[model samples]
Target: MTATATEPSRGLAARDDRVATRPLAARLLSRPEVGSLIAAIVIFLLFMAAAEPFRNVANVGTILYGASTIGIMAVPVALLMIGGEFDLSAGVAVTTSGLSASLLAWNFGLNVWVGILLALAVSVAIGAFNGWLLLKTGLPSFLVTLGTFFILQGVNLGVTRLLTGNVASADISDMDGFASAQNIFGSEVTLGPVTLKITVLYWVLLTVIAAYVLLRTRVGNWVFAVGGDAAAARAVGVPVRATKIGLFMAVGFCAWLSGMHLLFQFNTVQSGEGVGKEFIFIIAAVIGGCLLTGGYGSVVGASLGALIFGMTQLGINYAGWNPDWFRTFLGVMLLLATLVNMYVKRRADLR
Candidate 1:
């Protein structure tokens, strides 16, 4: 009787262990990150089925081309949001950096490397300012970054105009660093009849690196801690301030990279470049499963979100629809995704 009972107990424990493990696996698969990826795939399929041009190699390249810079920024932005902060000036800062690069190269006749370094330095400074204001004033990041956003916006346009006397832009192609920037951001590869911009490959590589760093590194652990609870993270010996500031700087650096691409790919730096993209980055981050309050997000999820944006941007055009309606479509999609994410998050928290 005792042996039979013990055998049954052991079987029950084994079953229970399996059951417990299953939920964890399921939970991992069902994370908000996974959801964003599903959304991207679903959107891509929907477009491919409805829009003939959507599946073409050319269109795919464009989708990725558009996604690259945004995707790059989205990773770190998601990190920042997960860390319970915001950087509203991020998009405008791209314009600032690009213009700075252009002016340094074209106007001042500086070496391209110097111009690039200057842009990066300025970006880091802007990021440091944002972090400082947030940490010192105890003001909400929304207000702080909003102020910075407007300031950068004005600076981007105002300074560019004052320097060039034109509303459009300055040409940086003749500059010394042009070759290197073009090599990195403007590289192209011939694939069949279509040319694939190699920056798309760069975006993919960056995404993989970002994902690995986010999911596999100790810094990633600290990122979660800071985002989950700043005070708690600090109490537990995490360098909350440094982590937050570093993330902001990363966002700035991404902005610089985007700026570099814009300067090379387009060969012009308009004062209006990257205007009104801050919220879009935030939207992508959120749609990728980032919490509005921070503490949870995924780089892959954010990249997928950027992919959705790119697909939608091109898909609507391929569907024989007015491209002007793209903003409306994006807004609606964002609203729905945010609602779904919020609902799912609340449900998970309850459980």
Candidate 2:
């Protein structure tokens, strides 16, 4: 009787894999951000040794500030990709937000806040439209957002010239709400040896919030589910549609924040300023351990990717090297990070 009972218990234990605890190394390897974290450290060491200015404490703030501009959008873009979508219009969308606020407030003699509010609405609506059209037509988001990208690019240029009689938005520094907007969006904060842009704070805040929602909430589960397999997620009663739409709207909201910062920080915005930035955001997401095929990524990883970008950008300039190779370095990192992510995933699965 004892032998029989023991055999049954042994069978159950063998079948129940959770009865065994995974090693700490295996657990860390399973995390999506591990590879990127490793890479970030290596890159930091490389720059720290190679460039003197890159080692300056104040330059840390500069690098963080640069990373923040990209991180602010990259975090949302990372989430959207985790939910299985793209937003090519994201680049021009920033310009659109700034231009919208600048022209609306200047031409109509309204408070800049009014323009800012309206710009937010318009940006969110654009994101909603993208999501709606993708769902209704059963089209890939790539094609949908690509179309949006072109439309917004043309509209940014055409509308800016038509309204402002120039290729840039009017300086709104003298307008009402400009001071508060500057304080909110473009302000700098100093902590001892470091001066940080407000966007950097927002970037960190967004990353923390996004990390919480992704790891700790039901909505986070839905995002992974939809990205892994939308039909399966829907079958499981997950609100796949709403999740994707909300993700896009998040991207839109962050874009508006970035746009406002541009408008206030420079006192004006170039109509063409954001034309190629979408690629940088996407690259940051990919490097941060987000896969090209979706369903796997981390917001923190994306931030690290942005940090790598900022470091390389400033590191090159500081080292007195040709900055032209910046994009080339990014392309290489993207390829390598993709390979590393795939290997890491396989290793995690094996573990």
Candidate 3:
């Protein structure tokens, strides 16, 4: 009896040891962000070695600033994509928000804060309308949001021209609350010899919050389930409509934040400023390991993808290459990322 008991204990210990000694490569490969992390490191090292200006601290700050601007929106876009929906209107919606804030304050003579609040409300409403239309009509989100994109685009250009007799809004830097708003959204913080935009902090904070919501909360489970199979999720009592609507609103909220940043940073917005940016957001999401089919993605991955974008945008300039080549680089990155993501997914499934 004693011998048998000792043998079982030994087996248990051996199993525990095997578990403890599992290969680190396996763990790393299991992460959705692992591919993005690798890509970021490779690109960083490449740019560091090849582009002299890329090594400068100030230039690094600029890269981070650019990344933050895109990352801030990318995170929410990733989440919405994971929830199995698209927002084609996201880019124009951002322009709409900024223009709303500027025109509301400048044209209506309201306080800047009021304009900000109203713009946020309008943005959220647009998002809600998109979500509602998708559910009510059982139509594809792509079509719904595409319609919204054009409508918002037309409104932006038409209203701006109608009001200002130009395609840009009047300057709002001198408005009441402009100083405070700028400090919150568009100000800079000095670290050592580098001045970084506040948007970096916002980007990081938003990523943390989104990651937590995705990984540690019930709603996160719902998000994944809904994205994976909306019908099954609904059958299991998940509030599919609410979850999707909430996701869209989250995107809207981020857009409002980004819009505020743009307005405060420049004090003006061209009606066409954000056109075609929706594709960039989608590409970033794809590069970050979010599947086009949804149900799998990480906010951290999306952020890293944005970082890669920022690096490439500046790195090429630092390398003294033609600016037009940027699109070619983006296409290549997108294709490679998609293939890697597919391979990773297949491996995970096999495991």
lDDT of each: 0.82, 0.91, 0.91
Give the winner by TM-score: 2 or 3.
Answer: 2
What lDDT tens digits, residue by residue, belong to model 2 across residues 1-351?
Answer: 999889998889987767778889888888778888998999899989999999899889999999999999999999999888999989889999999989999999999999999999988988998898899899999999999999999999999999888999888899998999889888998998999989999999999999999999999999999998999999989998899889889989998999999898998988988888999999999889898777889999999999888888999999899998987898899899899888877776675
In terms of TM-score, the best-performing candidate is: 2
Per-residue lDDT of candidate 3, residues 26-112 (tens digit): 767867787889999999999999999999987768999999988988999999999999999999989999999999999989999
Order of the predicted models by lDDT, top scorer first: 3, 2, 1
The local lDDT score (0 to 100) that residue 279 gets in candidate 2 is 91
Q: Give a tens-digit lDDT track for model 1, residues 1-351.
A: 999889988888887744555467557655777667778888888988989998787666777778876787787788889888988888888888888887877777788888888989999888988988899998998999999999998887887788889865677777776888799877888787676776677678777987787789999899889988899999989998888888888888888888888878888878887777888898898888888888777778888888888888888888888898988977887887777678667655644
Candidate 3 colliding pairs: none
- Cand. 1 TM to true fold: 0.91
Clashing pairs in 1: 82-295, 83-227, 112-177
Residue 180 Cα positional deviation in candidate 1, in Å, after optimal superposition: 3.1
- The parts of candidate 1 lying over 4 Å away from their true place are 1-19, 23-25, 343-351
Q: Report the poorest 10 consecutive residues by lDDT, candidate 2.
A: 342-351
In candidate 2 the C-alpha lDDT for residue 307 amounts to 89
